[model samples]
Target: MDVRELRNCFGRFATGVTVVTWKTDDHEYNGITVNSFTSVSLDPALVLVSIDKKAKACQALENRPFVVNILASNQEPIAWQFAGRPQEKLTLEWEETEVGPKIAGAIATIECIPWNAYEGGDHILFVGEIKAFSYNDKDALMFFKGKFINN
Candidate 1:
């Protein structure tokens, strides 16, 4: 299928907005936008995030731990900022946790260590072992079709 058709098909499923972030050599690299995140297991606290094989962040995730910033409804701008405007000069505040760094104003933040990885068509599935979690009581930022919406 073509890109638009594929996107339209995938858009049927609404998903929460997430910014999957990782650090390397004292510098932070982030994906800004991701919806391919889900809980996998409760026994081992495993979560999976599917990253495009060609995405810059995929390279870092191959061998490094990262942070999953689950955006709060109020943080929609943060989602857009990370999604396509990384250099837009927006102020981002975050705190450090046992596993990694997390966005300060996010609805929920998960710190994960890369536990497993596998190729899936055009994406790489990064299974992460949850080390810690935190949350702020608020609505979530969601995405549908080609726009950002509230959930």
Candidate 2:
């Protein structure tokens, strides 16, 4: 099967949008939009975010603390901005956390410490041990069939 066809097939599954943020060794803030995030374990409070091998943030995430900002329905611009489509000097609102910067209006924010990394074909699966997390009662930003949806 063609790659695009396989991708489209995968897209049929609706998933929440998230931005994974981390700090560099120089204290620079970096983030990337991802949908390949999920809970891995409850006993150990673990979660996972899959980053494309070629993405710059993939390298930054190695052995670092990071936050997963689960986008709210109104945060599509934040999603696009971090996804590498900067819209002319967009300013992001952030709240400082012990782990990293959390998007101010995200429906949920999960802070984690790097636990393990694994080979995932063209992507790298980064598992994190959850350190802290919080959530709000807001609609989530979702992706399905290659488009963002608020529900």
lDDT values for all models: 0.82, 0.93
Off by over 4 Å in 2: none
Clashing pairs in 2: none
- Across 46-140, the per-residue lDDT of candidate 1 in tens digits comes to 99999888887788778788888889877777887776765466788877666666788888888889899999999999999988888878999
lDDT of 2 by residue, 1-151 (tens): 7999999999999999999998778887889999999999999999999999999888888899999999999889899999999967667888999999899999999999989999999999999999999999999999999999976
Best by TM-score: 2
Lowest-lDDT window of 10 residues in candidate 2? 86-95
Per-prediction TM-score: 0.90, 0.97
Task: Rate residue 14 of model 1 by lDDT.
Answer: 87
- Candidate 1 global lDDT: 0.82
